[model samples]
Target: MEVGVWWTRFRAVLAFSDAVVVLGAAACVPLLGGARDPWPVLLAAAAAWWVALGVGGSRDQRYLGVGQEEYKRLVSVTVHLIGVVALVALLLRTDAPRPYLTTAAPVGAAALLLTRWGWRQWLHARRRHDPTWSHRVLLVGNGATVDHLSRQLASRAHLGYHVVCTWEVTSAHEVDIAETARALVRLARRNEADVIAVTTSDALSSELLRRLGWLLEGTGLQLVVVPGLLAVAGPRVHTRPIAGLHLLCIEEPTFTGATRVAKRVFDVAAAGAALVALSPALLAIALAVRTTSPGPVFYSQTRIGKHGRPFRMVKFRTMSTDADHRRAELLTANELDGPMFKMRDDPRVTPVGRWLRRYSLDELPQLFNVLLGRMSLVGPRPPLPDEVRRYAKDTRRRLLVTPGLTGLWQISGRSNLSWSDGVALDLQYVENWSFTTDLVILWKTARVVVAGTGAY
Candidate 1:
């Protein structure tokens, strides 16, 4: 039941799962009609991939159930393995069997990813039911920072950090570094905590942090120092060691150039393809909206986009024909805070509109907006002019990129998210934009839309 035991068992199961998947995929190459004498190349590639994953830090205890780093490393290892296989084939002048090189490798890689995801899901379930299965974390810092960090960790149980103890030292007076370090180690040992999460403060200076690390040198306890700067993504952060000092460097957020062009191209192509593929469903939704309500099939409202530009955002009409005119009467009944308006059971929403909104079928028309260069497949939610006007200076950063049909807001909680929380998620996405992030968001959007949580 201890955290270390659970982690060891989890990692062992994950390795076993990876090996089975790799061998299964390799075995299928021959069964699925591959080249003769394929066993040597196929088996070698499988063994290499399995070993790479085990040694590549993909299964590191720190990255098991949290963040995208594990998945990213998995992808990187797969790519490297494939490149090595191809180079070997070219140098030896022996054409690798197409099935072994292409089909088996890709299948094995996909299966490995799925296997890791499955193990994460299992680990999360176990942690949820038995918090002891999670990483026992001891929080160390000033009171305010510790409280803030504790609240964050408590809210995200799936991250597997369970706060077991807190050591709040006041910054008003200098503290004894050695004494504090010894006390921290004692507290961690007494509480059986696997991690010591420290928030930076004057009282817990760099010297104290260094001492704490030294005390925990061979204790097998992780020392996690949370920098004062919050909401910065990993991809935007880099570490530079200079003159015996480790410096944290934050890269400027990307907004234009090749990244923009790549994003734009992806948006247009995906939107165009989605429009064609879902034409029939779109027609059905359009017909339902038109027949069930006395309003037009599509509703276009002026929304604020990138750089504060106003554009007509279109969606399947999910309210009455006079929805805007009747909005004044329902202003006081709005369920959401801030400038946005939302109601769980608004009287103006038609029966069909309610259904459309639940599954987000109403937002399908925005694919056209995406194709028109006014919107993106993934970015901050497009705000209304009133909302934009109410935005504080920092909040205005959401306009740096084209608005999205679905973004962090859509997956996090949609209408269920508070105004401050919504702003924070948007800002995090804006500051940490990556193509991989977009893909992950898009993939999660499908599940959120199906579950219909946080939607009115």
Candidate 2:
């Protein structure tokens, strides 16, 4: 089947699921002591919520199978649904029960998000086995950009982009604008591609891009221009049309103001709560580390935090007391590249330490670091002073925000991640930091910890 047909069917499934959830929530309102003859209020609320989800671009094809934008739209729509419900009640002079509105909003939103997540999993699973479910992408650009973009897309098959072919235009002088555009169209047709993704290239001028769009008119092929910038999130970018030219406006991420305050507050509150909740486990781990190894239960190491500030980062001792003494001997056997030292089976690691590190239980003591304002619940990994010294200028951006106990680096393959890959993930997180993104990362961290595939 065509990718469009599959997407359309998936969207319909989402709409139907949403309708069922909304109606189901409305039906339960009367039981919750809602308006007596709640039929009118219930039906109106259900109809409005369902329609709002549809028209609000909650299920837009662009965000259907990838990224957090779809979930963001769902959240925005749900928030607006509340305002619309209240406004309607005021205008109609109906005594819409507060309980019903409150109940419906949260319940409906949760159910909708849950269903969407489940459906996304299903779509990803299907796409992995059968490429027909994904968008066949034709990449056009300079060789370097094409290579980078292709690798990224191919690595994440869940994103639903399958690269079919590439047209590498080395320079603007080598290719005529009209000829390039026509060649892209013919190439896309030959490959049966659904999308033409033109990566950043001087060979593709604005006029040529515009001409390509003109030529693609009524051709049912999607045109996407990939910017040169890397690791940028949708929230940080805005596009506007002025004087018939599209201008891309990129927003710089700010680490100050109310958002920073909110983040600090969240880190403190969450870290405190986590410590309280996991107190019993923490004690057990400390006891295990002390009894299993002839060393102190905790290890403290100087790590670079925000702005290159050094702090003693604490963790449950996951190595023998002589681990540091033996480090010089194993330095040559380091499994990971760059400044970080990681050995899958180092002789200095105690048996208990190995278990703790496997599931990252050793990092639990970092909750104290988070409380102490020396680290964050989520951000880039706290770098070693040696690692910081070796960092390139671009890599120093990790210090712009407080270091994290667990971050994209931790959740994304942890020790298994190549140093460059880990650095890229950290940079991406630094640029796209958000409360919602943090919540998502924390949730994923739980799953990753349990799997323990990437941990040493």
Candidate 3:
């Protein structure tokens, strides 16, 4: 907590929130004082609040720049402190000031949440403007996993992790750590990396992974595992401690029960609402497509849907009429692969098509797909039949769920990622399907769409 690496931006958020709590507590002392004298009690409560935050890992630098993990811990600590005060008041049998206590509870909670949001705003601004503050990371993994993870980390600037260099091991397959620890130490020094990420897969020796943990304990460098290199999503994998050994269990991707119902509800509500709200914009896009070129307003293509069924995915026509017929000729200039073609500066695209693709307005009609139950509001990207043939056995699992208008692939660089990456992302999405991850992906999709990056 004191010495390890934390995303500096995250640290700033925690620091600001902590300050708010302290200041709020101080402000309440005057109004909340009991008639007899409440100075001691107030001081003690304030002290307990700070101490609990410390014990809860709320101040740990490791969590500073990461995602919701830090906020979860902060909430946990805050709730415990509030509970302690509630219990003490109940036991003492003294009438506490109801107004101050009641007001403070809600106010403090609101402040905590609001401060985190505000801090995030500031952090994002800093990331855009400040170059020196980039997160310095030392990636450690064997062959393929290392390369994949590095690229993933490199592209997500908002996540703030910068891959300075890597400790190249045998690969994600062989986890022999006999020489891995020494290797990590050398790499960390060479790269001046602040953190060490171990992405070795489960096929390797677990003991070696554990020993690498020991090797890192005294190094003052942060240690994090990729959790699942061959798989995706943290929730799909769980750890259990039985008989002094830690066993990792990875469950299959199956959204059922209440989860499935909630997803359907969200999809319908989102898609239904979006279609109704965007009707004017949709009509405008159609008119633009019709007026911009001599072609139909809508472009429809056969894409593989859930369980390997074919469905017509519709978009506003962005390319020339001959674009589809001449796809083969354009494959030579393909910038993206894996059974599909993506040309960065496709000569086939009409000027309007290029602009339409930029902001993803062309995909707005997919709301109809989502409404028809042929696709989801969020899931894996619907692929072409030719693309489906190339999927490895594990990658085929992505078809279990409804296809998506904007998926992990769409949210993360879309046409920019490589062939192997497309498969990995699909498998990861299938394996780690969760309502929360889906929400995050949707939120990220907004940013990617606005940036219009990798659109071609």
Candidate 4:
């Protein structure tokens, strides 16, 4: 199962799914008592929608497996299709069925998106166990750049990239661009690679990159140029071609703005609603903890928040009353790397406490922290004061925003993550924070909690 062949099949499936959605929407129009000859109208609408999707690049392979670009293109195409329908009706001056058009557009778009999401889930699941679904990549660049890019890609296996081999250029000046391109082609062919990824290097000039692209032309292998910049989100990075050079302009991350305000508003509304809606469950958890453990129902610990401020983060007590006193005794048995302490089977944890921690029910009390503006619904995990004290200068940037009840680290692996990995994820979130990213994290958090992985 070569990646190229698999991708072609995947694309065909997507096309079929889109066609089915269009047909279903058309079928709905006749059922809704639209025009006498609904077939013509339905066909016209379907054709227009398909054309719109093509024009908007909704089916672009580059955006298929990763990022929100695919979703954005779908939304854009759907909107354009609706507008086209309205304009045509206005110009033709005919009795158009407004209800049918409105209903079909939304329904079709939703179905298409849902279908794509389902496929993505299936693909990701397959990738978890088998690398066959992933593109075999031939990496070429300077040593440092290649290693960095390889690690980044390897960490995100869900993106479907497997680095098969790497060619390290000690000095780009020593090799000619034409020769390098030939070498790359040979390596790709030898490794049966589906993609050739060249990381940005100081030695390689833009002209050389262009030459490589020209060499890869009509070769069936995709050539991807990885920019040197790290931790930059797509929205912040804009490509501008000026003077025959592709310049990537990166924007600084926003800390305060209308977007930030919207995030705050969402956090407040969601946290408040959850507190009210889950009050019964919260009460039950409190009672369970109180009856099962010889400790207070709630545990409040000093955690570092935004700008190094300290706040009392509350959680349902998940350990015995003497847990803190016994911390020194278990220090030698700490299972987690870095400053945080974790043990899969700690003697201090009561049976009920273990269950609460597993599903993150213990952290439900943090809705109060979010409501009080001491935390957010999505951000970096709140670090204990002792953990914060061990932070390096670069890690301190995570404090620029409020801590979160759930975040990249939480949804990623929770206690299973190494300290450095957790910090890397947190820093990535801090540097590329967006409302969309928050929504994705929150959605993933639900799944992670349900699975109860990496929870201690």
Candidate 5:
């Protein structure tokens, strides 16, 4: 089904669900110490809520998925509606029951938000199995940019964009703007495209884009302009209209503030609690490692941390005692790219070590690092000193914050990632660090660990 039709149906379903919640809350009023004759006020409040939702664009197609903006708008609209209701009650001198109003507003809002979240999860699940659920995207730009954007969209399937066709132009100046716009319209119709995404090109002028937007009017085709900036999140990017020009402003990454302090506090509390809670498991792993290998139960390695500081990162020993001594001989057989050394099946790993590595039980000891302020619960993976020495100027930015026990790299493929891909994920995390993003990464990490994929 087309995304537009699916969205329309989804919006209708949401409206019906919201109305049910409002009525359900109204029904609870008398049971929760309120007047039985609450139907009139409850119906009026429901009508006001419906109008507020529409005015706030809570059901807008653009803000439907994967972000907190839709929920924020929903809460905002509900609060405003409640305020208006209270104002009207006051103005009319109607003795509104406080218990009913308080209970109904919160309960109804919670129900509406929960239903929206459930629907979003359903949509995401459908998108994974059915390509038809995605918005059909028509890409237009130079070959390089088109390929780049296509790969990005392909990597994040949950974003609901499926590139149906790509129109590659050597230079936008090669074609007339009006002719190009006409060609796009024809192509979009032919491909049943819901969106036309154009990547940044020097040949395309603002005036040309303006004319193209005009031509696309009434065609129901949404035009999206992709900026050249890579690895930047929405919170750091803003559009400013200066005079007649729409300038895209990029904000610098913030490494200090109350948020950072809160992150540290959370890391300490979570790490400390986890250590205490999992102490029995930790002891069992230690005993197993000690009995299975000649080496010590715990291994500590010097890893580079925030601002070029070095710290001892502890982990369960997963290799024979002579593993480090044998490193030089195995360097030639390294399977990984860049400065890192990795092999799917290394002879140095003991029998128990292999199992520990496979499930990442080896890294559990890093909670101490997090507790001691040497690392965070979530951030870029700590790099070896040798890895840091070989880093490019841009890759060094990952050191701006504390290293992590597990990070984007860990959840996103772990040992399976190539050096470039690993570095990119780390840099992306560093540049777009947020508490919400951390929570998302941690949730995904739990799932990934359970699946035991890409771990050596």
Candidate 6:
């Protein structure tokens, strides 16, 4: 574990920068409206903006450089300041000067965001190898939750937290209220923590939580309780107190409506344009495949789809006509344990076929499936029928969405990933699918395919 000293220090910079930008924006009001004697009004408005930013928690160290908290503060301050400006303009009946007052909102918001991005870039560059870079927090749970938290942070260290130490006892489902409280108190005291992250699994009793909450009240240290919010991003974690009990109102997963329509529209539009753009190349590939081997140019096989439907997924053929019958000969050479088949240099591939598969040009024919709505332009790869057949009940949850031409697994390490790892990635993608995420994956896919990294 380490410290978020940089992140915390950056918060102060953001706060102070926010104040300056507010002052700068307010100053612009007079110049834009051509008001020579507007200094008094500008100063008052600037002062109010600074006060509003502080009140909106833009400078809170607790939210530094993590999740959407920083962004929320940025937005909240902007809206509040704009409200103040609007109220002033309305009171003064300044119709022609309205646009002048509006200038502060976007200008201040952009300034704050730009400042944060620049600071983050500097932080990431300077602290890549620094020992005390990220937040070093005491992880106060003994079981799977702690294990998961530690592994996740370790995997993506730049997200910036180190587990440092895990303090005390059994599984997440074991309940021992008083003893756990004692354990929690001792661990917090021993760690000299700047932050105490309580991973409250079912095992940690509410009494223990309350006890720890009470014991740490006056320590001037940060306390955080993390419920098992699953793959839902941090922005979704909202607490609503109903009848004095804090009820966390987690939003439901909805993959339908405008977003879905947009994705499909993008899919069809892109796929159609690609086919038109690559018409000659596609024809040449087809002719090359037919001449190089006796088999068909394109291949179609049954694959599992959304909601457990079976569909014939299409791809350019990359092996001999009877290669499926020759599988037994290569069975002993298989590198993977589970059902999916992959080898770096399989002898069954023809010269042209090998080149096609190497660059993933062979999978380009899946564009047809995407256009047909049988597959997505970006999503989890359509699992083979046999592959889905072997899936454990939980693993099949990914089939809840249409399989994709490219996905998280494709960009991560394709055929190189183990079966368990592949499913884990697919599930993560399904759970966290968003338009931006899809766009990022599509961009990364080009690089991965070009390099032929981990491709068979």
lDDT of each: 0.88, 0.88, 0.74, 0.86, 0.86, 0.76
Model 4 Cα shift for residue 398 (angstroms) = 1.4
Judging by lDDT, tell me the better candidate of 1 and 4.
1
| Reference-based lDDT, residue 112, model 6 | 74
Model 3: per-residue Cα lDDT over 236-315, one tens digit each: 67789999987887777775778978998899999999998989999888888899899899989999998999999998
> Could you tell me every candidate's TM-score relative to the true structure?
0.93, 0.93, 0.78, 0.95, 0.91, 0.74
Clashing pairs in 3: 6-61, 10-64, 142-171, 143-171
Question: Which digits, one per residue and each the tens of the lDDT, describe model 1 over residues 170-262?
Answer: 863668888889988999999999999998888778888888888988878999988987888877889999999889999999988897898
RMSD to truth, every model: 2.2, 2.3, 5.1, 1.8, 2.5, 5.1
Record all residue pairs in model 1 with backbone atoms less than 3 Å apart, i.e. clashing: none
Write down the RMSD of candidate 1 (Cα, Å).
Answer: 2.2
Better of 2 and 4 by lDDT: 2
lDDT for model 2: 0.88
Mark the 10 consecutive residues where model 1 has the least summed lDDT.
33-42
Best candidate, TM-score:
4
lDDT of 6 at 16: 77
Q: Give the CA lDDT, 0 to 100, for residue 67 in model 1.
A: 88
**10 residues in a row with least lDDT, candidate 3:** 1-10
lDDT of 2 by residue, 156-227 (tens): 787799998999998788879888899999999998898999887777788888899999999989999888
What's the lDDT for residue 155 in model 5? 79
Candidate 6: which pairs clash? 1-164, 2-136, 3-134
Residue 193 of model 4, lDDT score: 94
List candidate 3 stretches off by more than 4 Å.
1-13, 21-52, 81-111, 117-230, 390-392
How far out, in Å, is residue 417 in model 2?
Answer: 1.4
Please give the distance, in angstroms, between residue 239's alpha carbon in candidate 5 and its true position after superposition.
2.4
- For model 6, residues 184-273, the per-residue Cα lDDT tens digits are 667756765566788765566677778877877877656678777756754456889899799888665557879889999999999999
Model 5 lDDT, full chain set: 0.86
